[model samples]
Each structure stands twice: as structure tokens, then as C-alpha cells.
Target: MLTFKVLAALLDYPNAETVAAIPEMRAILKAEGVDAPVLLLERLERGDLLDCQAEWVDLFDRTRAGSLHLFEHVHGDSRDRGQAMVDLAGLYGRHGLTVQASELPDYLPAFLEFLSLLPEAEARNLLGEAVHVVEALAERVGRRNAEYGLLLAIVAGLAEGPAKPVRLATGDMDEDIDAAWAEAEVRFGAGAALSGC
Candidate 1:
């Protein structure tokens, strides 16, 4: 639905395009009866774009807890996460949605976009499968930014059912936040040392 698309855009990093679209986004959300993000849209519209961008980076990019990648919370760098991403990407492809090379299929915004293309019941059912991740993200993000948390809460509400309780711990002071948030390198076909075997 358009509501999900609007919510997805709001969840993404704030940019000039998104900032400029605030009035239209607000209208879509209101028209869809999704009012949780109205205040967020108002704040974004009134705030400096640079400052809004900085806030988005601080919340989503700087910490594992606030990651926009849903699998980061679900699989946490495990090998399973890679396979899960592949499966999710395949799902998107089957549904005629092509994810960008730079964007993971499981990214929350992308996932929301996918939902926007599906029938309401099916969309809610799919979202329900990831409701725990959405709820966890809401808790983590809300703890730091209530507006974002509300957005995610609205997302979870659109799911088919309530999410189960999931406790996600925050990082410790001794942890290396940068390393924790670093992107893993993608390697081509064969192992570099395969000649030695």
C-alpha cells in the first residue's frame, strides 16, 4: 500500500528528495490512516536537512542495535544470515522486485517497499514473519529516538499478529562500534589459494 511506501521512505536516511516530499508523504500517511509518523514528518520538514541526515546516521549507521538491515538483528553476522539474504532476494525476484546492488533485500525499507506491492493480507502475513525484528528495532530505536520507534511500531502494527518478546542487548563501552558496523567484503568465485590445493 502507499502507506507502507511512505513509511519506508521515512525509515530511510533523510535526503533532500525525502525532505522535500514531506507534505506529500504526510498526506499519503494521513489518507491511509497511518498517523504515527506525522510528528516525525513535521520535525523533518522543519529541521535542517544536514542535521536530519546527521541524526539518521547517528541512530542507524553508528550502531548495530539501530541497523536498518533486518538480518543484522536476526542473524547477527552468522553464516545463516548470508543464506537468509539469498533466500529473501530470491523471494523478491519471484515477486518481480529487483533489489539494487548496493541494497540488501532484507533492508527494512526495501522489505517495506516489497510489502507495498502485495495484497494487504499477504503483505501483513509476510510482515508478521519479521515482526520480532521490527519490534526489537522499535524498542532499540525508540529508546534513542521516539519518532523512529513510532514508525517501526506502526510497521509492527500492520503485521498479521503481535510480535513475540525479544530482548536485544546494547553494545558495551569496550566494544569497537566501527568494527561491529563494518561491511563484510564480498569475494569472487574461487578461493585465492585454490592453486595450492
Candidate 2:
């Protein structure tokens, strides 16, 4: 599904390749009834490639609130998270999706790519696994007043079940982005390690 590809592109680090592909992706997403992503597409469209790349790094790479890796939201870098990664990678292999080492299996772009390989029902089923995480991230990104949150909401919308219950209090997470920027750059891990994860 091109909508999946569009989501993947938006979640990836934006660059000349990503910027150049925006128009066609926009058309595809619109045809797929995905209007929410257009907000992000518009941001990219208005900027030149460099500006878009900067925005991507600012919004995603630099902040936990807008992190693109799905597991970072839930698992962090705990052994559990690593195991989940291994299992997810195995699942992808079963489906014929090979992920490179540099790209974590839980990365949203890669996850969306995996979804693109499945039937809609199966895709929705798989997406349901991260509905709560997506919901929380959507709320966080929305608080930033960046329309990119809508893309996360769109991911949650793809799930089939009722909204998943979340124990984490996302309402009090006002400093997540600021806090993320303060910490040294650490990669994924559970608990406190998540700030950099």
C-alpha cells in the first residue's frame, strides 16, 4: 500500500531523496484516504531539502517525544526490548523482510514497510501491538503543535480493536522533549536509558 510507504517516508530521516519523493507520496496517500499525513507532507513541501532534513532531525532524532523507533516508546533498551527486537526481526524474516543492522527492526519506517507487505487485516493486527505507544506519541507530538502527531494517530487508527489502555501518564509528559535534549546521546535501553533511546 502506498499509504504505508508514505508513512514510512515521513517517519524516515527526511533528505533529498525523501523530499523529492514527497509529491508522488502525497498523491498516493490522498488516494488511499490518508489526509492526516498531508500535514507533514505540507511541511516538507514548503521547505527545501536541507530544511526538511533539519526538521526531521529536530522532531525525531533529537527528541524522545518524536522518536521514530516504536519499541523505544515501550521497551527502551532492556533485555526485553532486545528480545522483542529479535522476535520481531524473526517475524520479518518469516515474511521475507530483511532489515539492515543500522536500521532497527522497531523503527517506525521499517515497521510500516513490514505492514506494506501484509494484507490490510494482517497489517492492522500487527499495528495493534503498538497502538498504545502510537497513541502516547501522537498525544506528545500534538502537544508540540506539530501536525506530525496526526501521522501517529493514523497508525493507531489502522488497528482493529478498541483503544488500548495505557498506564503511563502522558499528560504530565510536558518535558519529555526538553529532557531528551538535555541528556547525553545514548541508544535504546529500558527505563532511564530511554531518554536517549
For each candidate, what TM-score against the reference? Answer: 0.84, 0.82
Q: Each model's C-alpha lDDT?
A: 0.83, 0.75
Q: Residue 16 error for model 1, in Å?
A: 1.4
- What's the true lDDT of residue 137 in model 1? 80
Count the clashes in each prediction.
0, 4
Candidate 1 lDDT, tens digit per residue, 1-197? Answer: 78788889999999989988878887887878776576788789899888989999988987787888888776777897899999999999999888899889889998998999999899999999899888878987898899889989999989998776654333332136446566775556778547446
Model 1 poorest 10 in a row by lDDT: 166-175
Top model number, lDDT: 1
Question: Per-residue lDDT tens digits of candidate 2, residues 130-194?
Answer: 78878888888777646677877887787778767755332346476358545665556567665
- Model 2 off-target regions past 4 Å? 168-197
In angstroms, give how far residue 71 of model 2 lies from its true place: 1.5
